[model samples]
Target chain A: MAEKRKIDARGSFCPGPLMELIAGIKAANVGDELEVLSTDRGSAADIPEWIKKVGHELLTTTEENGVWHITVRKTK
Target chain B: MKIVIVGGGMGGTILGNNLARRLHHELRTGKVRITMLSASDRHMYQPGLLYVAVGSMMPDELYRDQAGLLEPGIVFHVDPVENFMLDKRQVKTKSGAVHDYDVLVIATGSRAVMDSIPGLAENAETFYTEESAVRMLKRLRGFQGGRVVITVGVPHKCPMAPLEITFMLHDFFKERGIGDKVQLHYTYPIGRVHSLENVAKWAAPEFDRLGITYETLFNMKEVDGKTKTLTSEEGSSCKFDLLIAIPAHKGMEVVEKNGLGQNGWIPTNRTRLNMEGQENVFVLGDTTNLPISKAGSTAHFEAEALGENIAAMVKVGSPVRDYDGKVFCFIEAGKDRATYAMFNYTTPPDPKAPTRAVHWFKVAYNKLYWASARGLL
Candidate 1:
């Protein structure tokens, strides 16, 4: 079973949300899923790019009510 | 049409990207071209330097490749400008390349001259550059306890930086458990602590709460690194264990060498931002000798208007838009909260209460700024 964690980075800006996601990914085990909530519009694109760069798998990303929820799985 | 932009700093890059997007149709049809000449390949997010100094951010995160931040249609040249042959309507590069232009935009921005104040180059730490910010961070980490003095040289960019440093220092030292052992001092050349009256008033309570001493009308005349003292033109002196001074700022040397500047700053039309006496030339950002705060936000606002004006000039030989000198500045009160001020040439900014929300907004802006440079925002 894959464990899951959530990072509430909502109301944080750019690198802020990105930094939080990195930390979240670091603490999670391999194959664990992490979700990040961010109000910054840039996160919708930046988070996916970062996950790809770090060899993480992006599960899904959804935006609703002016917030972005990005989900990723740790690969290594 | 060949539009050549000199200097690839924030203002120059943003304007180039915007212009390239606006002229995309003409570019695809081979009727227009945009070129940007940058001295170096790095584009620095200058506002983040403060965070680097406070140990909240890394220096590497504040810079990016200049070429990568431009739109697809714009050409990027990694060449240092040596001279502006305004008479010939061309620019000469250090590599012996001469580029003619139908339109030229000067966005070389400003540079900090440490030599202006004696001993400052040898003693003090400044946060204007990545190297200096890193050095300041190292110095702060080793700070035991003493008087910390932060002063601003007049007419510098980001007038609120010294204040931000003061507030951040207060929070930093408090967190380190030496808050009482260190005395924080701030000095300004003007009579008021801030250029904007309302901002000064809004900061009063915060300054008082943080126990940061504010000194006004103190123009730094010289510094004695050996003695660890700073002397002002008014015959006042303050001794410090560590000194953080914002060095004197001036326009790029190439501009002064070409007789394009007055007192080392390019003079431009207030509303249109066109260089004085040069019909096809434009100036924006800290390079211009405008009586406004030399902030990135000011440049951002000026770029919005200048881009429209340039497009109109290329099409009809006249500008359809007018700039009102609007500028916004976000002041970081501490680690978690920030405040903002918005104003223009004729009106003072309405005071906004400090909040964590504004701080988050500033954080968001830092990320969005890259997108903006690429013309995606």
Candidate 2:
């Protein structure tokens, strides 16, 4: 079964959001979806790069109200 | 699980406080224990040393009681680690006590080795330590006017110290009304003013505008006090009236003695931040052999990542997250202007023009660093 988790790292900086996503993925089963919310501009750009390199699937990255929402799915 | 942390510098102290907060329930229930072993009872805000040298700040403001910084759940001790027993998962301290841990963290910071070059310790005025900063301040106060040469060494603790001290000194002499009488010359071991390409590009013009001369590719091989000369490996010699040095750094003595890594830097997995081949032993701060700049911000970020992962490991039986070589450094550009560099493993820092607002933020951060060490920031 595919599950979904949201990591609230809205006020955190780069690597903080990415770390939260990693933690979410660690606790999720394969095919689980994780979304990270970060206000850090750096993290919004960096989180996708991390997922791409790690062989995960990046679904979408959007920015609204000075916040970035990044969604990814566990591949392995 | 017994979590034993070695070296109560910024990394260890922050990690201890972070875990204490994260694992408060486990700590209260005796399910997990966090113990911190440090050499000194005091914590020094190292960045203030540069300000101390320039007579802008006092030495007393740089330190705090290390024990007071920790949370109530942590077991803090003033015992320095003398030997590492990694195989047995135990460490012997200077006071002849042995501590065993399921997980160990090494955060023993690096030190400036002035004596590495001949006559360096005797001739050059460096501001790396509290004593050295005070001595450098005295040297600058007594100095009337002459050719002042600043030489930098590789692998130092603070990445921006060389440039920061130069700009601060330029202002220092101007305030003393000796700006015209003194000629400030800066030298770097590398072919640029700074190791970072963008920073060098930005700083080179600023150095010119300030009328401070600089020489790149000036690697200091030896310093002769009698001749008042500094010789570089590339066959360059410079005469100096007063010499200021940014000495090379090496890992702590205990690290070198334990054969952890070459020159006291432990071989660490860049992402996992663990000692190579030892999953239970983690290395942070200046102790890790990571190629990133060994700045306090580096340690702080690493401590945050490690704190999260360690706490998760205890709770979930698996560690989560990796440190992505993130380091943020504030560069003081003198004249009440400052800038910052933020970068990580995949990206390089693009520092824009200097700003007074950023400088004030840096000033504010100097005071707020205590909260940072307590894992509150």
- The candidate scoring highest on DockQ is 2
Candidate 1's C-alpha runs over 4 A off are: A1-76
- Chain A structural similarity (TM-score) per candidate? 0.92, 0.91
Summarize candidate 1's per-residue lDDT along B273-323 as a digit string, tens digits: 989898889998999866667888878888888888887776787889889
- lDDT for residue A8 in candidate 1, whole number 0-100: 67
Give the TM-score of each candidate. Answer: 0.82, 0.83
Which parts of model 2 are misplaced by more than 4 Å? A1-76
Q: lDDT of candidate 2 vs native?
A: 0.86
- Determine which window of 10 residues in candidate 2 chain B has minimal summed lDDT: B188-197
lDDT of 2 by residue, B1-377 (tens): 99999988899989999999999999999999999999999999999999999888899999999999999989989999999999999999999999989999999999999987889999999999999999999999999999999998766788888899899889899999999999999997555687666788899999999999998756677999999999975578899999999988888989989989757878888788999999999999999866678799999999999999999999998879989888999999885999998888667688999999999999999999999999999
Q: Which candidate is the best by lDDT?
A: 2
lDDT of 1 at B109: 90
